[model samples]
Target: MNFRRFKIGYRTLKTAVGASIAMLIAMFLNLDYYSSAFILTVLCIQPTKRKSVRAVYSRIIASIIGVGFAFVFFEGISYHPLVFGLILILFIPTLVSLKFQDGFVSSVVILLHLFDSKELTWSLLWNEAQLMAVGFGVALLVNIYMPSIEKDLKSFRLEIESLYSKIFHEIAFYLRNGDSDWDGKELVEASEVIEKGKALAYQDVENHLNRRQNLYYLYFDMREQQFEIIERVLPKITALPVNISHCYIVADFMEELADHVHSGNTANKFISKLDEVKEEFAKMPLPKDHENFLAMAALYQFIEEMDQYLHIKRSFVGFNMKKKTASKES
Candidate 1:
């Protein structure tokens, strides 16, 4: 037993050391010596992995253009003076702001710096190109290996369910208590939290294409819908309160919807029930007071939208009866 324990501890230590070394190697690869890296870093902070690809590609293209321009302009200038520096300082930012940022644009500026020194040549441009290509390659490799957006779909389901539950409880609070004076801050807070969850979910889907590549595109598309829900209801979150028990009931169904998604147990009947709740919430009486009614209505609509979004998200997981049956039958 003592020998076995020693062996296990050695293996564990070896594995831990190996993992730490691998992580350090990854970080080293991501570091850069070029000014272009700064700009590329900015462009690369996309919410999705797909956008990372686009940003890197853009930077590569830009670098070539900028470098080529530098080469051409350097050959033409006779004297390196304050004039050359001043001219490019004003020109590059204009190009970046007006058009997409390109690394070649910066290369061109670098070329200008070399122009006055009269040391630039085709070889110099070639070296710069090599440097940029390496930087881009490093970025791509780092992102592919360790995407910041990766999350297990199952965990995302749990997070989203928790958010939906919170929203439901907030709605229930208003409905059961009929607190007209109760500001809708809780609902707003829930919306804010859901928005964060949506963003995180979308990002996770994007970064780990291997995990849920089929839903990657849908994740981005659905975020827009979720944001729309937030926007429509956010302004009402702080408004005068009204009786929204009915809305809370609908919100409860939305929480149930997330459960259905997780359990992979939602049937046509559940869907119909959801639809019924949605309809009831939609048709429920509103306050005669325009402000209170409108706020309540906004909250109701927001929950309805969430229900619709959840439905769409579930479709990817095949939560519908038709798909679930097919899955089960298979």
Candidate 2:
């Protein structure tokens, strides 16, 4: 069995290895305060690559600023309670103004070193820089070996498609038989699955430098929008008193649509197909009976919902295509 499928595998193991390596490197170099390297590595490991990069950027800057401020404050002013308070007042505002607040906690750690050492010397400052470099650098290198997310992305896509297929099939069955076995729980499951899938896709984006838009993210978003319409469609399906002629028509259409959920069919083609259905229905006589009228009304509402779902799906495709074309041209 693939052990990495568990939560405590590759990522956590890599983090531990990275921290150990950082400390080893620091010891080999004979740097003072070598444990700082291990500490920094632990703090730097993040859920997404983008977050790790941001953390490193802000912390490095914050550490440098911290060292400089502490050196000046300790040497130029008396190291009294009032002086420390004054330094914090100035330093906190400076970090906020520079938009480096993400590093505030790290900066405090940097300040603590100055407080304990009481030696404002170049040698001590160099040690701080060395630890930050070795720690963050090792962490970055280890994180770069991220496993291929393509497989996971495809898995999520298939899951979402399956959910959509089930929903459509259920709708078709309901229209055809005037009864449905579907518990409507797939709607909830689909929402949860899409949201989780989107989060993973975002992490994939963070792993790449040149990634503009993740197709899986777009795919999940399209599914999520359609999910809302599906919610509306189900109620209308259940509200009709009895099956009408249009109900059979819609049942057949939904069944056909379910077969093509993962077919990569163009949204425009579906839109065109819907136009034909609308036109064909327009040529028929209006419903004469109260039961037929109710069923026809529900069928019309269902068609509108399906049309909206298709359009939303189309919007993602069209927008992403234009983006890719522009990227290629540039």
Candidate 3:
């Protein structure tokens, strides 16, 4: 395996701490099933505390199901290999159909332990309950404080905006010069960056239980939309039949737009600038030949893309940016 990519995170520390604490407490209390506490702790810890929170309920429910099935199998039927098979046949399908499949493996292990008990009794069922409480309780307390993703989210934002600026600068250079050294590798980088950013942004949102809004997600969403337009628009830029003098007007506009990609504010200025370009296009002579026709069509499409891109930025202006409200103020 690639241990080179492995780095211990806060979540790992949390899980370890929680499991150790649960085990210690169980040992002190001298519970009949002390191992269950540690087992529960290991199962409950999630990469994100929110995930732990969500999974806890399922773990509890699945434990109940497993214990319940074990009780029925031990008492209703004989404790034979065939009975265990019958229990699985009923248990697996029922859990799946209920959409509680996440607990299936854990529940199976739990049932196996109960199956090997010295005697089937109410105390056995009570022991399982104690394990569940210890495990789920430790997980809940440990996950109360989630680590912040603000720093990482900021890095993604800066990188995304920087990439946008580079792409726009390249596009303008290509439009005017009809050539560029850049191969659009940044599109691939941007895709990975944005996908990761959106996921982290979502985790950031999940960390805050009461806050429903997600600014970073919206920010990435806007960039993702712009990314789509840019991929479509970039290739056509080099093919325009116009020279530098003809492309100069749009070139200057693009460079100016590039400067403001990270502004994250109202886009009135951008909208007005695009309107001016559209007006200029309106007065220009219509394309008669195929080459000019394609160039003109590309120009029109580029304008529309820019307009939509600017609007997406505008949509998140007053909302959260990087998990904080007052993005416009920023």
After superposition on all C-alphas, the RMSD of every candidate to the true structure, in Å, is: 10.7, 4.6, 2.9
User: Which pairs of residues have clashing backbones in candidate 1?
Assistant: 62-103, 62-104, 63-103, 63-104, 66-104, 66-105, 66-108, 175-245
Q: Could you give me the TM-score of model 2 versus the true structure?
A: 0.87
What is the C-alpha lDDT profile of model 2 across 163-273, one tens digit per residue?
888888898998889886678887888988999999988888888767867877877877888888898888999888977777877887888788777735666667777
Tens digit of per-residue lDDT, candidate 3, span 81-160: 78989999998888888777777766875777677783577877777677778877998889888867789999998898
Clashing pairs in 2: none
Clashes of each: 8, 0, 0
| Of 1 and 2, the candidate ranking higher by lDDT | 2
After TM-score superposition, the amount by which residue 212's alpha carbon in candidate 1 deviates from its true location, in angstroms, is: 11
The digit string of per-residue lDDT tens for model 1 on 52-134 reads: 67676766665555544455555565445654565467547745784645444445544544563476666655555554554
Please report the candidate that would top lDDT against the real structure.
Answer: 2
Clash pairs for candidate 3? none
The candidate, 1 or 3, that scores higher on lDDT is 3
Query: How big is the positional error of residue 330 in model 1, measured in Å on the Cα after superposition?
Result: 24
TM-score of each: 0.52, 0.87, 0.90
